[model samples]
Target chain A: MNYGLRRVLPFFALILICGCAAKTMVVLVPDPDGKTGRISVSNQAGSVAIESPNQATTVSSGKPPTPPVAMEKETIAALFSEALSIQPKRPVHFILYFEKDTALTPDSLKQIADIIAAIRERASTDISVVGHTDSVGSREYNMNLSRNRAASVRDILVKQGVDANSITTTSHGKENPLVPTEDNVSEPRNRRVEVVVR
Target chain B: MKAITILVTVTILILGGSVACLAALDYVGIVKTIAGEVVIVRNAQTIKAEANTKLLKGDLVRTGPNGKVGLIFEDDTVVSMGSNSKIMIEQFLFQPAEKKLSFIARIFQGTASFLSGQLAKLAPNLVYIETPQATIGMRGTHLLVKVD
Candidate 1:
């Protein structure tokens, strides 16, 4: 009986410790557009406090906390590291333009090396290729052209050893233009494909 | 003498197993990228940060003037830090099968970006990033924050 009790005691202690353990997980993802953002915190129990170079506040239960506050680039990096215990990874973005009505261009071809290098740096990642077109063609025609452009880029990445399954391709056609223009207009910047590696 | 030696061996094995289990439960994320000068403060010791570095709860990460680093949590969340910044990870718990998740961290100074993953999609409020002056609640897919 003595030996049995000794063995059982450790298991019981383990169960108790596991049941009582409470941990907090924090995740800080950057804005894809690299713009200033805000964060808001409220205390559910005890007191949640925040202190920044510009201001400080303590939030108690049952009262409204401070309003959503915008942060600068340096401030965001510091706060994010503090909360997540890890540094955020820089996101890689690329824009490649298409020729008059096709999904190929000299400038876009030049960007292939940069895109491949970015994807190879990470062990595993997700790639987004969004195709766009100028307002020089009909909506249906533009949509098809944009999709073909995105597919063309995806093919190139896959050929360069990026996993095809990790790539997602979509088309915005003329709906979302980098440089908005009137109908039947040809904007060089608008007819492009944007790639994001995360 | 033989019996005494056997008993001592059994005791050591039991203790070692428990220690290993505890260490396994403490890991929350791993360093995916590091550039320039980055370091981590853990248990009062400062260690240089590098790729594939394992990060635990209660760890403080700081970067120098040219330092930059990236970290990915178990739940696929990504965080990248810029130079001249500091951050503290207070607590992290992710168990998707059981629907249990919570993340809390504080940024003392500097700039950082965050990309939400499974935890935020499963339950957004469970993840919290705090600054010296304000607390950030994520309502979107990506966020860039700076304290000073």
Candidate 2:
């Protein structure tokens, strides 16, 4: 009876070990926009870095992750299909330059229609229109000007039937410039309103 | 002296309450898609999730069997989970202007697809995806994780 019990104990131990094998898995894939990135998986034992697309690693108990191996597309799709299927569409960002102060440039003004279309398409839960200014004025002056710039964009969205509560406006006040310039320099590119719909 | 101490403590309490209220008003993420039974346990309150449900830091998301859900954080980070999944939004501090940024998420069980956002590009090392066994350090990338 003792010998039989020992054999059964070994069998249960084997099951435990196998159950712990690859119990946790991680795979690096390209970002939604197809941009490549890398991930380092680490445990108390050691770490392995994977940059290749579809590379995967299995974390085991009390051991460093196994070396990363490239996983098949089908395998990845099958395992992650549910999560993938529910993936949200990427946020859309738009930059509309200001002609002067708070006025939208002619080309940018014409883009209002397209911007509205994007907001509608996403059924955007929230929208942020941040205003920026070239360093052409006093900091306080630019701050107020930037606020107005952002408010103008928000007004347009609200006028177009977007919920006002869903839109937020911010002013960067020449603090974050697209084209870095010395104070009081009018950089056209730096004077812009950025809108992100998500 | 004791009265002054009590006054100071009361003032701190009031200030803390206001800060919490302000923080609650600022949502860090939104639920973009939900199918089946997905609920968010936030501050110990179970709120049924719907499309566009605002999510706050420290919220725990659990997906029932046959459930699936997706979220997009303020910085465009995306996370989608499958059925029988539990995820915690442990911490999120993004202030691009001040350069204060961190995003950490812990998954207790099930599968998830993660897509990094602005933080991934701005400061990848500050983002982390932690599981019961291992931790994933990212550098502007996407990841799929499963725990069974």
In every candidate, how many clashes are there?
A: 54, 0
> Candidate 2 residues A93-183, lDDT tens each?
8999988877899999888888889888988858889999999989999999999999999998888888998888889897888888898
Q: Tens-digit lDDT track for model 2 on B23-140? A: 6677889999889999999878999999989889899999999999999998889899999999999989877767889999999899999988898888889899888889889776
Shift in Å, residue B112, candidate 1: 0.8
Could you tell me which 10 consecutive residues in candidate 2 chain A have the lowest summed lDDT?
A: A9-18
Per-model TM against the reference? 0.46, 0.87
How high is the lDDT of residue B76 in model 2? 85
Chain A TM per candidate, in order of listing: 0.65, 0.85
Residue runs of model 1 more than 4 Å from their true location after superposition: A1-121, A124-198, B1-24
What's model 2's interface RMSD, roughly to a tenth of an angstrom? Answer: 1.9
Model 1 docking tier (incorrect/acceptable/medium/high)? incorrect
What is the DockQ (computed on Cα atoms) for candidate 1? 0.12
List DockQ for all candidates. Answer: 0.12, 0.54
* Model 2 alpha-carbon drift over 4 Å, by segment: A1-22, B1-24
